[model samples]
Target: MPHSVTDTTTPASHPTASDTSGRTDALHSVPTGLYIDGVWRESSDASTIAVENPATGRTLLDIASATPTDGAAALDAAVAAADDWARTSPRHRGEILRRAFDLLTERAEHFATLITLEMGKPLAQARGEVAYGAEFFRWYSEESVRIDGRWSTSPDGKSRLMTMRQPVGPTLMITPWNFPLAMGTRKIGPAIAAGCTMVIKPASQTPLTMLALADLMTEVGVPAGVLNVIPTRTSGAVMTPLITDPRLRKLTFTGSTPVGKDLIRQSAEQVLRVSMELGGNAPFLVFEDADIEAAVDGAMLAKMRNMGEACTAANRFLVHQSVADDFAALLAQKMTAERLGAGIDDGVTVGPLIDDKQRRKVAELVTDAVDRGADLTVGGERIDGPGYFYTPTVLTNVQPGSAVLREEIFGPVAPIATFTDDDDAIARANDTEYGLAAYAFTASTARTIKVAESLDFGMIGINQGIISNAAAPFGGMKHSGFGREGGPEGIAEYVETKYIGINPLDATVRNSHTDAR
Candidate 1:
């Protein structure tokens, strides 16, 4: 059984109250049954799994646990609606998506509060995520009308070749717990904007946010069976039928690399179109020529956002050997000032880990780094209380072989390592199985260009702390997984290319490399 967030004797009241207000009642009111055909329906199996509040270990509610039969039904709904939805004018699709964006903006704070209660991110940060998630809907809404391809003729001037883009059919959206709202909207926004039907499966740890998003979509008049959400605890049960079913043409996922690998193999059974935004181990490098104060500020924003649980969060800091001590000292001071408490609290800058399991993993990583001779500069222990938490930690004198740099430290742990120069810093930063995101601060334009071009990452933040936007591509290279999201290019993942050849006086077939989709 999960532990209670507050006293059981008190009546449920706002989550922020001492009674922890009726936040559970709000979750209970949400229809947890499988959403198919724009209607709430019971799963084939009546079993349900409890969703716990990560910060307090309290049972928020029980969501319907879907079986293979539920997966098939959702697939059937998507397949039946895909062609008709695709045939609808892109303007119409775009309009509905835009409306969703408007609704998200209007309800931003509500969603933010819900996110904080469920995922344990600070209320302020959760509000930011809600806004970030809304951007996808707005961006994709405009891109819907721009889904055009190339038109050209042969050199002989006797034949014409036409290429067009169309929806990739029904897709499955599997999102992780960290950015539950944003990831789901990122995938669904583009898929629907491109005229593809979808079934969303959010992480069980934070399904309420996605469910609430689905409810809003329905309010804005999304047609029957066009968008569905299946909130289930057992992955194999629902995913097996959905993946093996040939009707489901695509699978878009944001999660760990290992799970992405497994899904890739399973998706091969149907040759499914796949888009993966997996794990990351981002590096924040600060060169000697860089402004130390600016670097420190950037480190604070990059390393502490969402309590450093983001995939783009800085896992390790690589500082120029000369300014290493100063940077570490300043960073440790800022990190120590972070207030760790319940995310729902107004003044709580930093919140607890999602659960004891996650907290333990973070503790174990710090333990291993200390064992490997990394000196703990500040915060090396967990907080004692009813919540899952660890103090914001900083490590110096880190060994070259420490696992902290090798693995994704998805916690508020910042480890610093000194590097001789740009070449040394790039080598150390790029030395990992993941290449999701990397950042550097340098005053030299030539150095910035050199470092940016040299660093092996999909997204780079040079002289800037924040990089993600609705107009920028968000994804990674190498084992971090391919395919971009959040820009004009994001829509391409949900679209397939078709070539048309005409026989006039002569005929020919023209194809380009970008058409490899």
Candidate 2:
């Protein structure tokens, strides 16, 4: 059975009621200023940005938006802190990460609440987000100590060849609004674990969780200037300069493909090492022999997660002709039963979209697809609620080349299409340019292995929808973006490799003038 965040109870050692209240009050009332060099400083001027809880459409708090000057200060702090953090022993780094992880776990619920309020994910799901967020810190904590440099001996034992990994200096991490905690943690975790300092520019919509995380990191004894969190203006005021800064060695981001490409282009001038996990329009394939119950369960589970705002959500459902009708029928039935409301509501299974823009985009996609002759079996209308709520919609017989199938619809609209044969299914699945994740459901072992190999995706799910784990490298192929974000390969994204070799009197060294072909 899969573990759930709701299965556990808060321990006695957890923060007391008064402490919890105090933290919440502090989060709401305190200045949401730039956290640079272990201090909260105003963002140069009176430029303030208000953060809202998407669940209730209520104003949560207002924070100072980091201006160009603030961004520069953050970059400067990161550079100044990088050398000392890099020189610190790996074991000590691991300890710092471990303690930070413990602190995160202790305040998991409080942090989850922040995500629910700011990001509009259900409270239960928000807890799960925090759990996933904590896993990064825990995984990279041990990984920091395991960053081993290799050595090779010469034939005469008179010389040695050595290779080592070094932090790529100060990093600038720009996170998206969806999955606020996870996005920030994924980038910041590996960079910090590799002993690299960083400045984070969280999305303007959901900055509270990242801000709270920064406070927790500082509380856990992370050195001054090691991590700086700033809520920035949406006009790209501070963003443009952060990525273009010469001192910023690495730029990590999780966002749309267009913005990601633009950032890559801007950073390319300085040859900045870029690591991105961009948008994905993952395909969900259901073969004839698949376990219908399991496939249906997986589809609903994938769609409702974060209100289907995730990059790896099963966007295009490519079903075999034989079972296409059945899959669609069952999926629509399951989705229709899901209750939609606020995140704090215990009975509500699906919450609102992050904001008005996301809601409008989702609504437009559904309308466009329906206008193109697709059948909306379940929800097709936005629920009238206080927040940015959208009904979980299931569409069947969606035509190929429809807007829903071609574009990344980051919402709870499941588009279904039928295929006749394996070749046809594979061809149709590969039709899209986006290839972050692909799914295939099958009971036949042979078909499972074959389809898994044939799919052109970074991550594939066979007989299961769950694809993320601490041990597995997670990323995508094609426009879904480049680089990875998990496992041992994750920390490598923040490091550069160097090799050294020495020759002695007892060893034969190749002559510089000698030519060997």
Candidate 3:
């Protein structure tokens, strides 16, 4: 994935009304140091990795990369801090989380700037991401003490059995670069609420926001080592040893399907508990009864979000034959009208790909699809420039066998196809190997419920484009990866169940006055 660094070229210079504002910040300064044991400290040496602004190919910051020794030390600190954090009162823990959430909201603009600089997302989108990230802490904070055990009556009526949920011990949280703040908070917030200390390894591509969040956690009085954010140049320094370590009881990740599987296999050495939110090729289904205008607008917002890097972003556009032509024409028009520019620039509707390699891969996929007979409707070429700029694209007449239809084109290329009838559409939607998220646009109550139930995806939105929220259980079925990452289910992922049994000496023995009454 390594390549020669090219001089950054700004897609555009000024901001426009269409551009998301307040998210961009000048990033000529370096943000160094790994946050370990509640302190911001450097790695053994001043070894640092340069982080680039995907929007313009500019070096945003130089972050300290932890070596193997530093990774080991972070783990040690987390282990040492686990017991005290677990013993802390649930109410107190919840208060700290709430405080962190408040701090994040108050400073949302700052974090959004970091996101725009490091991840190349629009200012508005970055602000929304910060809001979403804060929600995770808010939700889990209240659910922390709600964990409970159950008592069951014994068959013999002489004994009682009790079951309770307990923390899973020190955890290793690895987040992808796509939604840096959101993913890290999704994992660590719930883990902390469940009384588990953690060591977080954020994607080197975007580590500033995560480090900032760690600073906030410490400011809220979160104990040292209760949450450690270690930004490293070499992922193996943290991942390899931690996966095999016995003390690192749980491993949580949000990344590609291949990486998720690899983590699961490697964690088998200690039989570590794992929760993975892997790759998804979500299907955007449109029915005859659906509002065409609303659906089209929603589709653009959903498909283009994060430059289409999200696992839950709609990849396949399944339009009913009744409205296929109109839908495609409208979608193509919307895409064409969009002004492609840097994340910080005004009037910019779409940003560049994360890096040159990603841009090349997207270009290859589009070319392959075109070569295979798919119609390139709106976009199919990389913009002539220095940065990794890809035009917002739309394709039609895409055969089912085409790579565009079969694989996840993790860019702004939206290849649309048509289908007739409910069963056919549902079948086509569920045909893929990945099933993390899906969307259906319809007004028919019966069809809405039926299609939502029938779709093989974990998260489905009916007539609504926004599917992910802190209150909902976010995950997928089949190859999308196992386990949930939001809502009450998310916090439960960090807990272990224990049972206690009690036996009475005799049936009805020693009946006290209070017991008889």
Candidate 4:
């Protein structure tokens, strides 16, 4: 079922032969095969999936497309290595993770280039991702040795209570294309730190970055079969059996809500522990008491980071009525100035969507918003070009009923609506079923605390825009999915706790009996 990119409809212009050649050379630096049991090899059928450059609509290279059998093999490898990996000393595991962090930092440019080429984010942004992603390894390296439980005396005074943490066993990690490196590292770092072996399925659209990271991990001495990478186009076919298998203990995914729900359903058969970071419809709220320029900067970062192809990207902008007009104008002016082109190009801030399908979806959302009476303030149409590029867009006076306000618009579009007061802003923001992330800009400390406490989101940015960090617990509630993915809590997701109770009298008797023996 995996088809080549050539089979898809081509864009107005293909990458020049020279361009393709240079990209091909870059691709050659990393493994393109399925990594299993410490070695990279072809899939069962040796079929390949074409990875396309969104900026050029040209084939970058073909990676090994895994089949159901290949998936099973990966699961088997993980199962085989689970016990030994779990038994490995926490300090030793931490050391490996630390080394991985070091190697990733040293090769930051290499991985960043692959991210930009495959995922189409600007090069600078890709570099930023590399830095962000590497932090996970660093943070978890320290967390590994700190995964501790507790010992306590029972309230009855007759027994002692003890607890210990252990790896959850073989895990399956599914990462999204929007953050090829960070998402993977966020999941992998914790899994490694907790001594859990895993098989990762990177998004087919941008598997190269993960593949390169896998290579780096191997070089840094991640045990064979401890980590596996399988990039497959037929994800359901490949993952269903693994999910049903008794050997698999945990499943973690970062993607859309629908797919996450389906995976959760599949996991239910085995009662597997699941951690999902699903879709988000984040809101950016601007209050009248806020500093306008600072609020604008926060809006830009909240709305435009990763070209707005992010689950946490602000989907709705609810500005107070007094500052609504000013916020919209300033945001539009800044958006209009962003240069759109290939991510590799110098000074380009925006890049193409992952594929034509994504571009079409963004266009449809914008059209629906406009048709529903939203004012198209700036950049409304698709660009005339070879790539799947849409103009950075800003829509003011967006109707509450518009699709843009309700749905997660994973594009470079910002829809601004007016709110009368704090209560109104909070109501409008929490109207959706999502609770992933939210942002508010205000100068008042009291307002910031009040709004932060009131927002129905897992993460809140009070007066600041960028909220994600390796040291923070990143996740969501409601339909946005559950389970933390960073910080000390992240490692907890990959661990199981065991409680032990010892009766003092029984222990004393056992000791006497042992002495007699």
Top candidate when judged by lDDT against the true structure: 4
Clashes of 1: 3
Per-residue alpha-carbon lDDT of candidate 1 for residues 1-517, written as tens digits (9 for 90 to 100): 1122333112222222334443333454466777888888877879786776666777666678777778788888989998899999999999999999999999887788778877889889999999999999999999999999998886655678899999999999999998889988889889988999998888988888888888999999799899988888788778977988878899988999999999999999999999999999999999999899899899988988988888999998999999999999999988888887777765778887888888888898899899999999999778765778788899998998888889988899999989997899999999998989999999999998998899899999998777889899999999999898989889999999999986675544455564577
After superposition, candidate 3 runs with Cα above 4 Å error: 1-31, 509-517
What lDDT would candidate 1 get against the real structure?
A: 0.85
lDDT of each: 0.85, 0.83, 0.83, 0.88
Q: Could you estimate the TM-score for every candidate?
A: 0.94, 0.92, 0.93, 0.94
Worst 10 residues of 1 by lDDT: 1-10
lDDT digits (tens) for residues 1-517 of candidate 2: 1011121112222212222223233245234778998999887887888787676566667788988888888888988998999999988888888898899998888888778767878789989989998899999998998887898987655689899999988988989998889888888778888989999999999888888888888878889999998888753778788787778899888999999999999998779999888888888999999999899998876767888999989999999989988899899888878877766556668888888888999999999989999998988887654678788888988987689999988999999999998889888888888888888898888888888888899999987877888678989988988999989999999889999986755766665456565
Candidate 4 residue-pair clash tally: 0
Per-model clash counts, in order, read: 3, 0, 4, 0
Expressed as tens digits, the lDDT of each residue in 1-517 for candidate 3 is 1112223333333312223443334332224688887778888877887788786576666678998888888999999999888889889988998999999999887888778778887777888999999999999889987988899868666788999898999999999998989998889788878999999999999998888888778889899999888888788656799789889999998988988888899999999988889888889999998999999988987799988988888899999999998999999998888767666655566777889988888898889878888888987877765567888889887877877777777899898889989999999999999989999899899998899789999999887778889988999878789889989899889999999988856657444665885
Kindly report which residue stretches of model 2 are placed more than 4 angstroms away from their true locations once superposed: 1-31, 154-159, 508-517
For TM-score, candidate 2 versus 4, the one ahead is 4
TM accuracy, model 4: 0.94
- Cα RMSD to the true fold for all candidates: 5.1, 5.7, 4.7, 5.4
